[model samples]
Target: MSALPNTHEVLLRNLNLVEGRPALLGVSDAGLLPECPVPGLAMTEHAGLWQSLAGDTVWEGCYGYEPEPSQGGSYDTVVVFLPKARAEFELRLALARYLAAPGAVLLVIGEKKEGIAGAIKQFSAVAGDVVKVDSARHCQVWSGRNVDALSRFRLADWLDWSRVDCAGVELSVAGLPGVFSVGRLDDGTRLLLETLAESPLTADRVLDFACGAGVIGAWLHGFRRVSGGSPIRVDGIEVQAQAVFSARQTYLNAGVSGDIFAADGLAAIKESWPAVVSNPPFHSGVKTDTSMTEQFLSQVARHLAPGGELRLVANSFLPYEALIRRYVGPVEKLAQNRRFTVYRAVRKTLG
Candidate 1:
């Protein structure tokens, strides 16, 4: 298998810090913080990434947006691993400003291809006088300080909300920068919603796996309401905190009630569902990863009630039909456009 990106190594090697300083790491990978000079607190919304980092004794891990108070009083240094979403990057910067003690150092690291240079300008706005500390292995590290002791950061001010019409139902959707399809509807999800409109699938409970921005779940709720089916309950599982937050806001704004949680795929869910729907994720950071989707296919059987259905939309090129049949049961192609395909699979009866 090809190696994942090496930006973490570059960041670790080039980080300039004194020993024993209390530190906080934001949105980082597995091994990045373990080798740092200071014992650190790491935060990630990705459950799989958290699992990989949980065993490291060098640093502690938190699985959500904010670190618990018991993690430490305050930190002398905070490092943010830049994500692709500009809003999320700003949110992390705001968080770094919030967590770092006055005059404490704040560092940001990312690959040049991921636009580390552009991020420097944004970093300077919140933290003062950014300086490039190191550049190697196609990644650059920049550092600044929280000069203003009285600066207050509010995450709510950073959210972007918009009105969208899906399947003729106007709804409000809100998302922070890093959430998928941040301020608008995605074509793949739109196709899935269209498919749901014509399908005969009905259930009292449904699962929205990989429910980014909560679009699929919220829309499904709306569809079920219009179809006059028995009141349907929706549960959404997302791995990113921002996406989970956005998903919750989407449901709330649309006057829909549902449960959305930050989790690594199906790991945290214990309930078997009558229907499962998703426009599953295929990419992680800058790497093309099908493993997550394949894992979902292989494990979804255990989460489905007898004769339950799994409906998914994917790019036409992914070989999901065979995998769905092998793991879940019989599969059928529901609809396909030039760029996307929708598939439905039924859970088979056990002997």
Candidate 2:
């Protein structure tokens, strides 16, 4: 039972959500990602939301664009959803400013507590005043005309976030402004990475699921390279291009050979000789989002060969042991602190 029960099912019923030939920006789980057989023309976000949330069946669009494809659309209107971050919403609106033609309209929809008003003010340059859509379910819609447009020049603030290093490694992290644990390492994540210092996937292909800023990935790579173990390779899977970019920089900075994909790389992951590692994402806003982590647990078991392991760190209080038990056998706790718990599970049999 998902929070958005039939999230996929509901998405299918909303085929009429999009209208005419407008290019849609800020399409995430709630807005777009067609559940209906017929896909929308286009979407924008950290990465390919349509493919994961719904499926590849609705693949009728351009995706994963950097400086994203804002301009060049013949679209008379651009629908912009107020994303989670005010700063991110600002950049997205700034990008859309150039895309909308003169007199064109920008439609924004979001939850009231998510700060949609601040977005309206940020985009005032390429627009007029605020116009709210129907207010239902605590969500509101608003619009503005392209009366004016302004360059934020704050592009780097939302895009070029970094982290302060502790321990032995000082790695760079790229993050979109509004993302969870943006611009730094999570307390739990840092604890997990520090504990896993003794374990390295020597000469094995390693996948860092939900890799943010490539912290865990680079940490492992650096230690293994120094230990002189078979030159182990790294691969990361993240849903955000910004996070992917930061992870890629970690690889580049390490001068190590690895792949970091913005796509949902964890979904298709199937490696016979590999080690799967993660500090999986388990929360969305104030709510718990176990979908990605559950999928990651299942996939980790599927990807590892005989004796292969899935090492993970999670909040100590979460009932992850049950989820881990569902996919892996003989699950064992490795370590624990007041805030976090680490586990090592072996892929005993084919699920």
Candidate 3:
């Protein structure tokens, strides 16, 4: 186990505000429940965090914005550990308000480096009369009243949609706050799609690993339709709840249907795919963490059907070539520019 995150540190210092049962949203797995005065509902959308807990306290692994109540009922206090995106912050604020009981308090805690100071302004908008309660370990805690709003949170209402041209077909994309490359296509994905367009893969099912907003999957569906190939099914796996919703909307908006659900990496995938295309996420929060992508590369081969292919795009600086060769099979560089490189690996079949 690692040291407690700074946000949890701030949470520990202000335990006095936790009146009645509380809801700890966006919680990490630092084993902090042992010290808390009351055992609150420890909730996190993150798959990694949700699975890391020891079941010492009540845990809720939510996949969507709306949080459900525990057996004890709605919370008297809702503690939100500020997310990495401002859009997500607002979403959490709205969600916290919806989850708390009448006259319940809302607490926001985060490190300064994670933009906790700027969030105080937004927190005040939803949680009126917000005040800084504590500042320690480079983290701050703010408390306020949870006021009911005029509007309810609909996940569709928060989506940011955009259109992109791929493989001679127009595709729609939907993204929520905190999702990677939301509202616009990123250059790396553009390069990967361009490469795929030059040589399309024919498969009944394709796995878009870490599929952010279903960009790659939607494009492939459109590409196949335009080329007069058999209709292809798209399977997307995303860890973030917002991205899962965004990807589902993206596929729906594109008039292409398949499955898009939340999962921590490939842990939930059982069926092998004929092809897997991804521009996998490289960052875990604000830091550049490639462990997820590396793990995907290491385990993806086993999840591929015989003669299946894995295609992905990544920054040129990252060392993924060795990992791919070591785990998947022989690798081939498909395309490259100054910033990104696309690679392909085919799973070997026994004679």
Best by TM-score: 3
Clashes of each: 0, 3, 0
Best by lDDT: 3
Model 1 per-residue lDDT tens digits across residues 1-351: 333356667756765553246555554555555466667777876767777667777777766565554433277877777777656776777777767778887778888988888988888887878888888888888878878533455556667888777776667788887788878888998888888888846777889999988887777777767777666778888888778778888888876767987778786678889899989988877777899899999889999999999999999998988999999999999999898999999998765
CA-lDDT, candidates in order: 0.77, 0.64, 0.81
Give the alpha carbon lDDT tens digit for every residue of 21-81 in model 2.
5555666554444333343345545465645533445443444334333444344566676
Model 2 Cα shift for residue 274 (angstroms): 2.7
**lDDT tens digits, residues 1-351, model 3?**
667788887788788989888888787654777677776677676756665553444544454474443422277888999988877888777778777776788999988898999999998887779999898998889999877632355667788788898558788788888888887889999999999889788778889998988998889888888888999898998887778888888888887768986778886678788898889888877789999999898789878888899899999999999898887778999999999999998887633
Better of 2 and 3 by lDDT: 3
Arranged by lDDT, best first: 3, 1, 2
Between candidates 1 and 2, the TM-score winner: 1
TM-score of each: 0.90, 0.80, 0.92
Q: In candidate 2, which residue pairs clash? A: 125-148, 126-148, 133-141
TM-score of decoy 1: 0.90
Candidate 2 ranges with C-alpha deviation above 4 Å: 1-20, 29-41, 46-48, 52-60, 64-73, 148-158, 161-164, 199-203, 226-230, 349-351
| Descending-TM-score candidate ranking | 3, 1, 2
Weakest lDDT window of 10 consecutive positions for candidate 1: 18-27
* Span of ten consecutive residues with least summed lDDT in model 3: 64-73
